[model samples]
Target: MSDEAAGRRPSIRDVARLADVSHQTVSRVINNHPSIRPETRERVLQVMSDLQYRPNRAARALVTSRSQTIGILSSSSTQYGPASSIAAIEAAARERGYWVSTANIEPRDPSSIAAGLAHLMAQSVEGLVVIAPQMRVFRALAAQPLDIPYVTLQSTELDPTHALSVDQMAGARLATRHLIELGHRHIYHLAGPQDWIEAEGRMRGFLEEMSASDIPTTAPILGDWTAEFGYYAGRELLRVRDFTAVFSSNDQMALGLIHAIRDEGLDVPGDISIVGFDDIPESAHFWPPLTTVRQDFAELGRRCVDVLLGPVGDSAPVPATIVPELLVRSSTSAPRPL
Candidate 1:
């Protein structure tokens, strides 16, 4: 039963040798210490990958109390936007040799949110990534006593220190303005549920842009961030058929709207131009190729890990809000001559 009679597994020294690094440097890399050089880090990672080396989490925790884990608190959502954010966070965490513990909760239920937080805390998570789309989630989280570093994926700007998010308002404005500049005076907005922070921010952006342009507005159709809801809303909107365009809050809803429009024998852009937010992968493949706003979910994920740990070195740049881009395609066009 003694080690002398058994074979030894790969050790830090073995990795150092193959990586052409000192054991100290290997330790720094394993711990994800900020002081390690990028080139050295990459080289060590490659060597470890080639050797199929995995750090002993239990052994490391015994010595350094470093679990090498991050926790994610997310609301249950099938919507592409929130789901993509969660996937991005997990991928980013794994790239740095960290494990992710995710706890899903209902954003509207304070008790559920509290329970989720308590569960993550019990694991002694080093940091937290909160995918809180609803304002109520923030309220619930703010009431908790948190000691670990936490970053929220939201544009609320309630806490500049702990908040990191895509500029939802700016992205919404980009979509809305695209419609206005197309000479479409009569336009509608299909917005998400009013309680959600992202939904509110986007709706605000749409209204602001419309008001600034001196464009008269009808009340936006609040949706459930579902393609089904978008379809139903589109059907209702076409009853009057007065508007020449619509800006959907997310791509799923836009797809629904597209379906409804086609059901009524209407053409996208030929009669009613459509614009959408959150350029999910399929957005690019929609019938006319969706004209939508593109969010850098992958970058947001990387920034979450980076901000949680802070800058790597003195010269490293701090993480900032990611700007969304507008993608124009066949889905939109200038209004037809009256």
Candidate 2:
């Protein structure tokens, strides 16, 4: 329908007029306020239905001193973790009748980060979710006090009260232990960039598991969470002596490693096995489907919004840790015989 033909959608005032009630009574019905009488509430609701009335979110927020909007500051929306988390938060907020405002942040600049936060504040958002995974962003958050409730997603060292994240360390341990259980004695780690919390957590998990097993640690191969970096790291490993299996920090990097290994005349599982994290959609389609850890980004986002909107009288902020599950696929196997 044409915008004009929609003929100016009906308003709360119109519903109130039809129901023979005050605007406040209509609002109480709309908000499901506990004090509203059942008969009065039903009357208001029926009138609203008859009039096709829609509440003006902004105007209502102003009257109640609430914006009913939440702000999200995120890194690239393409990456699996941040992207999935944002989608989840949006879905959860909508379920609760809240709106979402998003800001895309470049990882490098402090000013850009500040500007994004300023914009959300200007919009009068009731809460904020920070999806930046770097230490710098964490430092920025620490340096400033936020008037609205805020939470950090995937943060490793954040104050427990305000931080929510998947247990990357736990996920990594699951991946490493899976490989170890398959009789792969010489396991190597292909790590993500050191500055990222996901990378650090995965590395810690791998190390802890290896240490617990009394297996000597090999120097980790480093990458920037890119397919290209994984390819390079894979090529370098090809030049070194042998290892039975490799654990990559993410699915993209593992894919790169797979290609590089094949280019060097090796076959996955036949020559060496591989495991990856993130379990991106395409992981299953790889030449040999990838065995991986699946992080619940959506759950993380939902929990973040819940924490932000939770009653102030609730118990102190407790760090919530999400455990990732290990997905076994064709990419992993028992070690090759000597």
Off by over 4 Å in 2: 1-59, 311-319
Clashing pairs in 1: none
The alpha-carbon lDDT assigned to residue 127 of candidate 1 equals 95
Best by lDDT: 1
Please give the RMSD of candidate 1 to the true structure: 6.2
lDDT of 1 by residue, 73-102 (tens): 989556688788888888989888788888
lDDT of prediction 2: 0.86
Candidate 1 wrong stretches, greater than 4 Å: 1-63
Residues 53-117 of candidate 2 have per-residue lDDT tens digits of 77877677777778889999987677887888888999989877788999987778888888888
For model 1, what is the alpha-carbon lDDT of residue 244? 94
TM-score of each: 0.82, 0.82
lDDT of 2 at 198: 84
